[model samples]
Structure formats: structure tokens, C-alpha cells
Target: MYSFKSRIRYSEVNERKTLDLSSVINYFQDCSTFHSEDTGNGIDYLTSQNRVWLLNSWQIIVYRYPVLFETIKVSTNPYSFKSMFGYRNFMIQDENDAVCVVADSKWIYLNSDTLRPVRVAESDIASYGLGEKIPMDYKQGNIILPEQRVSKEPFPVVPANIDTNHHVNNGQYIKMAENYLPDQFSIRQMRAEYRSAATLGDVIYPEVALTDTSCTVCLASENKKPYAIIEFIS
Candidate 1:
């Protein structure tokens, strides 16, 4: 496992002065990226080889969100790799070593040019040797759509939503889904499934479904095909 220690920054917090859900995802994403960089399989190498890793799904469970200025440790480890897919775990711990958040994620290795799944090389797998899977009731990547949903006004994908791959960042989709959440709804867990990439100029028509215990948001194209589906459990 690879880890990093840092204090929760003001910019990372929400109006409640605590680290927000999107920042937590960013930390986990960065931790894995840092691990790859240190292992000599970073951006430069991946770009040179025309290879990239696209997040397929995320399952994050938060025990509590850390407040601004709080010191915390973020860690991540790849637990398994199969063909074009990789499985990983992430955790955020407080200064006292109590875990505040844990997440399991699935990613697909891809050919950058083709944007299609590709088998990860043996060398790449060796670089990040498998670690023990963390404790979490892992869910499948597929998210079940609610029977009833309401459509929101369509919005264009903005520049801030795009990542290095020129598609909407995985965390951005979660942030987008949060826009439709109930006021003061506290999320204990979040799951997102990326169905397709949404790039600049693409219009997103959001469809939201709510229940007593959860909210589901499907960020879809104008034609109703999903770019991503996110579920927030309160």
C-alpha cells in the first residue's frame, strides 16, 4: 500500500467546513496516481505507450468527513488485476489512526487512441503487486436505476469537468449528482458507474430519483443514454 499524510485544506472542504465527498475521491485518485508515478509507470510513460486507466466504477463509504485543518492520512492499494480490469482499495485515517473513510474502485486499462479496453502488461502488474483486499461489502459496477425519476434541465460539459483524458473526471460526475440531492442529506456512501465518456460540448441531461434512504442521478446524453450513474446513500 502507498500512503500520503496531509492536513485537510480549506479549499477541500464544503460549506460545513469538512472535507467534501468529491475531495475524498480526488485524494484516493491522486494516491493511486502517485503510486504509479513512483513505480515508473506514471503519466509520461503511459502517454508514451498510448495507454491509460479509465475509472469504471467507485464505491466509497464514509464514516465521517474530516474538518478543515485536520491532519489525515490517505492510502491506497491495488488488490487485484484481471485482463483489462483492476481492483483497488483506499482509506482515509485521522491523526489518531481511526479510519474515516474507505473505498473500493474498479478501473479498466485502455488504449488511449482507441479508448477501448486493453490487457495490462505483465510489467505493469508487477509494478504494483497485489495487496490484500480491504474489508468492504463490494458491489458490482452496475447501478440499478430507480423506477421513477425526474429530468433536470440540460447542461453543457464545462472545461472544469474535463480531465487529462479529455473526458469528464470521475469525481466530477459525483459532484454533478450531488446537485440534485436533498437539502442537508448526509451521504454515508456513494457509488458511481461510468457508462461512457462525456467530453467538451456534450450536453448532459440529468435525471434524478429519490427515496427515503437514497438518491440516484443519471447523467445522460440528450437522447437519454447515460454517461454515468451515481447513487448516494444517506
Candidate 2:
């Protein structure tokens, strides 16, 4: 596993001074990116070869939210790869070595020139040992939204929402959904599936369905086709 230590910065905390869901997801993303770079298959190298990795889905479970300024360790490893898909797991532990967050993610290798999926070369990632899954009961699954639900005003895709890929970053989708959640609930787990890319000037219509213990948010286009689905369990 690739590991790195960091402190929860003030900017990463919520109003309650606790680490926010987007920050947790950022930690996982950074750790995996570092691992890829360390293994000689990082963004710079891949892009030079006309390739890039795109996140397909994520399932994150949070047991505890570290407070601002708390020290934590983030780690990740590629556990499996087949065809164009790669499966990885991530973990965040407090200073006491207690695991606070666990997540599993799926990513796809893409040919930048054609913007299409391509097979991941086994030798490119074989160094990170495979076949071991994270010890968590949470599984990645489809998130279904009811036909009728609360629809919020469409959010314009601003300049800040665009990332290096020229599309709305994955974490931004989670943050947009979080805004629609009731203030009474505290997020304990989140599962998001990326169905399409939303770029600059594209407005997203967010719709939500809430339950006693969980909530589902779908960010879609004007025609109602979804770009991302986020399920939050309180």
C-alpha cells in the first residue's frame, strides 16, 4: 500500500470544524495519484502517451470525521485490474491508528486522443500487488431515484468547477449533492456513480429523494439524463 501523512487543514473543515466529505474524498484521490506517480505511471507520464485515468465510481464509509488540525494517514492500493477497469481501496486513519474512513473505487483507462476506454497494461501496475480487497461490508451498487422528487434550481458550471480534464471534478459532484441534504443529517457513507461528464457552461439539475436514514441525489442535464448519482447514509 502507498501511504502518506497529513494534517486536516482549516480550509478542509466544515462549519463544525470537522473534516468535510469532499475533503475526505480528496485525500483518497491524492493518495491514489501519488501511488500512481511513485509507480512510474503517473499523470504526466500517461498524458505524454495520450492516456489518462478517469474515476468511474466510489463507495466511501466514514466511521468518524477528524477535527480540523488532526493528523491522519491516508493510504491506497490497486487490488485488481481487468480490461479497461482498475479497482482500488483507500483508508484514512487518525493519529491513534484508528481507521476513520474506508473506500473502494473503480477507474477506467482512457486514450486521450480519442477520448475512449482502453485496456490497462498489466505491467504498468503489477508492482502494486493485487487481489486483496478492503475489509468493509459496504459495496458499490446502483443508486435508483424515485420518479417524483424535489428538484432544485439548476446550478451553472462555473470556471472553478472545471479541472485539468476540462470537466467538473468528481469531488465537486459530491459537494453539490451535499448542499441539498437536510441540515439535521450527518453523512456516514456515500456512494457515487459517474454516468457522464459535465463541462463548463453546462448547467446541472439536482434532484433529491430523502429517507429516514439515507438520501439519494441525482445531478442531471436539462433532458433529465443523469451525470452523477450520489447516495448519502446518515
Best by lDDT: 1
The true-versus-predicted C-alpha distance at residue 85 of model 2, in Å, is 0.4
lDDT of 1 by residue, 1-234 (tens): 899999999999999999999999989989999999999989999999999999999999999999999999999999989999999999999999999999998999999998888987788778788899888778863789987999999999999999999999999999998999999999999999999999999999999999999999999998899999999999
* Candidate 1: stretches off by over 4 Å: none
How many residue pairs collide in each prediction? 0, 0
Candidate 1 has a TM-score of 0.98
Best by TM-score: 1
lDDT of 2: 0.90
Q: Which regions of candidate 2 fall more than 4 Å away from where they truly are?
A: none
Q: Which pairs of residues have clashing backbones in candidate 2?
A: none
Model 2, 1-234: lDDT tens per residue?
A: 789999999999989999999999989989988888887878898889899888999999999999999999998978889999999999999988999999999998899889899998867677667757879986735777767679889989999988888889999999899998888799998999999999999999999998889889999999999999999999
